[model samples]
Target: MKLREIAHSRTGDKGNISNISLIAYDMNDYEKLKQAVTAEKVKAYFSDIVKGDVVRYELPNIGALNFVMYSALGGGVTRTLAHDMHGKGLSAALMNMDI
Candidate 1:
């Protein structure tokens, strides 16, 4: 099943960094999300775009996972000529991943 089936995501950006938070729709599914969504997988998923590192922070208490991707904004909002400079679409792209 796709990760979006069980969770939703929110994204934010700062300079060249992008932060995405995936929150489980049902708390019970948090564990499954944890096991399936790793820093390595996320980094690989966005390999072409994220030029730096992907760090995963587990928010078990909130039934969520936060991914901090470095160098993901093509040099921040002002510098990047990309359409999605803020990388908001990245959250949607990640949601398409199979869990």
Candidate 2:
């Protein structure tokens, strides 16, 4: 599945880091999404494609998940360590999940 097919992304740039926040369009999709996408799981999701650190924060109040992908070109060059292509970045990346 593509990310545009599942969720919408709200993106922000804070200095050298980029913050990508994801929310479900259909509220009913929350549980399914939560199960499929997790903090640890997200780390794996972006592990190969992203370098530095991948931090996942769960917001229970909003029933949403936020991903802080460090050194993944928020406002800087791509990570020098990993060669994986997280093409299109987070916004397009999440939509591409099989879920």
Candidate 3:
């Protein structure tokens, strides 16, 4: 199953960083997500776009995970020639991850 089946994501971008919050639909799925979603996996998944490290922050109480991706905005919104300067599509891209 893909992560989208169990969770949804929100994306934000600032400078060259992209932040994505993955929130599970149910607490029951949190454990599965925690085990399956890792910084390394995310980094590899977006390797072509993200140029720097990926960091994951756990939010057990909320059944959510926040991923901070560095150097992902093509050198920031104002400077980048990338189509999606805000990286909004990133959330949908993440949902494509197999879980």
lDDT of 1 by residue, 1-99 (tens): 999999999899989999999999999999999999999999999998999999999999999999999999899888998887675789999999998
Ranking by TM-score: 1, 3, 2
**Model 3 — TM-score against the truth?**
0.95
How would you encode candidate 2's per-residue C-alpha lDDT over 1-99 as one tens digit per residue?
655555677776444455677787777766766787765666677665455676777766665678887766533535434332233355666666666
Greater-lDDT candidate between 1 and 3? 1
Candidate 3, which segments miss by more than 4 Å at Cα?
A: none
What is the model-wide C-alpha lDDT for candidate 3? 0.92
Q: In each prediction, how many residue pairs overlap at the backbone (N, C-alpha, C within less than 3 A)?
A: 0, 3, 0
What value does the lDDT take at residue 88 in candidate 2?
36
Local accuracy of candidate 3 as per-residue lDDT tens digits, 13-97: 8889999999999999999999999999999999999999999999999999999999998999889997875767888888999
TM-score of predicted structure 2:
0.67
For model 3, give the 10-residue run with minimal summed lDDT. Answer: 82-91
- Once model 1 is optimally superposed onto the true structure by TM-score, how far is the C-alpha of residue 45 displaced, in angstroms? 0.4
Query: Among these predicted structures, which one has the highest lDDT?
Result: 1
